[model samples]
Target: MTEVSKITLIGHSGWGPVEEAYEERLTVSAAEVTYRYHPIKATAENVAHRWRYWTDGPALVNAFENLAAVVSTW
Candidate 1:
C-alpha cells in the first residue's frame, strides 16, 4: 500500500479539539501535509459525494495523481 502523506480531518468548528486530538494521536503535521479540512458533516451514505462537493474535488484528484506518479516511480 502507498504510504499516507496527508490526513484531513472532516469536521467543523464544533469538533475543534476533537480534530486536534486526532492529529496529535496520528503525529502527522501540517508541514508534513496533514491538515484539518473539516468541510462538512457528511451523512453516512453520502460522505464521499458531500466531501467532493464541499472541498475542491479537482485539487484532491490532482493530489492523488501526483501521489500515484511518485508511487509508480517507486
Candidate 2:
C-alpha cells in the first residue's frame, strides 16, 4: 500500500473579491494544503474553449514552479 505523505488542493471559481488571502486558517498542522486564487468571469461558452486566462500567462508557470518546489519536499 502507498501511504499519502503530502497533498495540495487547487480550487477555482467564476468570481471573487478583488484580493484574496491565501493563508491557511487552520489551527492544526498536517501534510495537506490548499490554494484558491483564480476568480475569472466565466460561463458555459468559456468552458467550451481552453482555459486561456491562466494557461497562457506567467501565472500558470509561476504557480507550477511553486507547486513543484513545494511537492519536492514532501
| Positional deviation of residue 6's Cα in model 2 after best superposition, in angstroms | 15
Give the alpha carbon lDDT tens digit for every residue of 1-74 in model 1: 65555544454344443323221112222233333332243344323222122344466556656765665565
- Model 2 over residues 1-74: C-alpha lDDT tens digits? 34333344544433445243222221111322333333243343332221212234566555555655666667
TM-score for each candidate, following the candidate numbering: 0.26, 0.28
Candidate 2: list runs displaced more than 4 Å.
Answer: 1-54
Q: What is the C-alpha lDDT of each candidate?
A: 0.40, 0.38
Q: lDDT for model 2, please.
A: 0.38
Model 1 collision count? 1
In the order shown, the candidates' Cα RMSDs to the true structure are 11.2, 11.9
Q: Which candidate is the best by TM-score?
A: 2
